[model samples]
Target: MLVSKYFKLNRSQATLDFLDIHIDKDIPVFVDPTSLRSLKTEWGHHCVSLLQNYFSCVLSAIRKGDDERAKTLLSCLNERNEFHLGYSKKKSRGHALGPASADEIWKSLSKSKAATTGLLTDLEDAVLFVDGVGPDMLSDAVCNIIRGPLIEYTQNACLYYEIPMEKEVSSGPVWNAHLERWEQSLIELPLARGAPIILIPKVVVRAKQSYNSNEYYRHYLMPVLQKHHKDTNSSLVHVLKGKKNKGEKRVYKTDLYELYGADKLASAKLTVAHPSALTNYRDAKKSTQAPPLDHTALAKLENIPNPDFPALLNEATKLRPGSKDAYLYEDAIEKFISGFLYPSLSFPVKQDGIHDGRKRIDITYVNSAKSGFFEWLSRHYAASHIFVECKNYGKEVGNPEVDQLAGRFSPSRGQVGILIARSVADKNLLLQRCKDTAADGRGFIIFLDDIDLRELIGQRYDVISGDSNHLLYKRFKALIS
Candidate 1:
């Protein structure tokens, strides 16, 4: 069963910030390090830093000929089955890189031309030159290195959804960027069928890694070989008969492939000779965008449907204000935002305490917007975090509620918030009060009533088809204007 279904969270994969992984089997996805470097969010940058530090340590150990330390470092990268990712055929029995394999990899790196020439920078680069190290192994190693951040993300997701977790679970080997080594911690984690599972963010996971040996061989290596064959007039070139022209020549790409098979060592040798090819490849990968998986793609992967916003909204509206079930409204809003504004906002935390744990925001999300209004907010208002306050009040929301959300904002945490209320007796009154908060230099607060939320939900289909009129953009403009 999927994690959401198992926990009865009443959520679909589309509405979740983290992947709703199967409890017993593995999913065919990977955490691409190149994708991590492509992210614009603070969280992404932090993860990239961790990756850099860990790999730097490995490189240093190999360079200094510290065989014992290098072996110890690589040994920490056991298959991380808890993530329920990779190509595990049936049940997720983790495939460990045993002592012998570790030694093999260590020796390969030690004697590697790519490593000696500074071409192997990140773990993903190992796929290009190192024998037997494929995307799955590199991804597993990355998972071990950044396990700390993943653990924190999982814990926060659990807290947001009220998922049950076991206390004092071993955190596995997490990379310590400061100490330049791996460390384990005892912390709370959600367990499935008596085994602990780590939640991976949907934004970070990919159907295939951006960095691939095949891609390097084809796009980078083959092109260089093509130029070489053309310059040398090698046998791989073909002279073709044209309709008008007397002579025309072309190269049989397939013949070139047959001549030089897709071998990593051969490609590495070519790269070493024409180092610019490697530089160009790195630049191209850096420039290419690695967009987060959309709702449809995520749904298809998990074999689930995208969220039914209208039905979800109806369920939330049915709950009575000030009742025991009133919290469901907050949960519903979180689901709605996560479903719609993903890749813009992610990793939502519930009851996020600030001011030394004295004040609690209802929901907080990392402002990970690559485009649209949230991106604008990040550029202009310093919205590193998106604060939300859910008020399930039966009547109109006034100054106090607006003040509460605005109070949660700061230059550091972000200066924008959204106040979600059941209904507003006077929409203009709430808007004016929110304006007053902005005018006072406290923060920007946008008020959304149930009716307005319903309007947003009603536009779901249009938005999904890429015909969005940018409703949130209009709402923010209305607030500031």
Candidate 2:
């Protein structure tokens, strides 16, 4: 439910649907290179930066004795108290400060005594020493904030394809980067193994709580830290946590000791790695052979209503070239792909691009389906994310058309694309050009005309027969090869 809520909040309906299919069918979701890159570079980096700013602002306010500003920032974290890093019904509050009044917070701050100074006049010092706004509270806030997005990203990765969590070992000496020591314990989500990793900066650890004591941290964060703590070649070295102060930038450890005192500082545990350290090991472990298609599910998918392709084609034929009515062809092709080719595929956005917005990708599909022969063909060509270009032209598709489709190919967007046209006179030449692109390592292009489109629609019901889709794929493969 947390995973569902997270996706509902951040992802589009198409992405939500893609995740739903995997959860309902209990199949692995396949994440393509493009999606993975976006998750790590764009989403991951943005989350880390936001959290760092929040931490810096709160810590700075506390250090400078700005109680009002600190309270305001602390409330931002408290608002999301209902959710934690992991999905569970048992309400473990973790380190979130409860909904106590500002008066109660200030009163506690006034009554509190500093761990080193004995008693404190400054309300900020009292607040730091008191129960609600101490180092532990700050650590927990960082953990909870980081956990929400980290778990969501991990769940999305799992939906992209099923990568099993590393099994827990009964007894092993695990390295604690924060403590700079090794201890004998059950090594959970060991970094030496093949699980995803998220690094937590040592500056964020408030109290030295064991990793497993907190349900969310144990389930979500520990595994990632365990897997990469000792790897020298790991990206952990390049993170913001690992960086040293060059000039005027405040040193994290020194600031904590100066503000929180030596006694309180002794309790803090830290790691010098960015909180969003993620390395996708899914591709290295991807199966060369795809799992078999579920015919029952396919049959059920076929029952879902789709546009009348025959009618769409007739309407498309009647519409003049460059007419806005021709846009119906894109809709028809989208339906054809979703209904006939793969149910997991959904068009999330149209005309997607960056900068000048000169290039508009006609249709982009987020393919989450792991079953079906066509799905296998896509996986075979390493195209988990698919791009489709639809043309309503009555003329033959030329090299220029083929080149446009090929231009969209990348390791992230996928090295395969589909070009749909009303017809083509030089089919051989187009096929030859596609082959040339494939040989050049740019991408593989498939051309579909009116005849192929009709054939796909006609065979939509034949998926129950199991071999009909395979035969169709073979025909397409032969044409392109």
What's the TM-score of each model vs. the native? Answer: 0.88, 0.39
Model 2, position 317: C-alpha lDDT score: 54
Off by over 4 Å in 1: 185-187, 228-261, 322-326, 439-441, 460-468
- List model 2 lDDT by residue over 114-233, tens digit each: 322333222223222344454335444444445444444444444332333344533222222233222444332212122223222111111222211123223332344435543433
Residue-level error in angstroms, candidate 1, position 24 = 1.1
Q: In candidate 2, residue 137 scores what lDDT?
A: 50
What is candidate 1's lDDT per residue for 342-398, written digit by digit as tens? 777888888888889999998898877666667677788869988988888888788
Least accurate 10 contiguous residues by lDDT in model 2: 24-33
lDDT of 2 at 93: 38
Model 2: residues >4 Å from true position, as ranges? 1-318, 321-326, 354-358, 461-472, 479-481
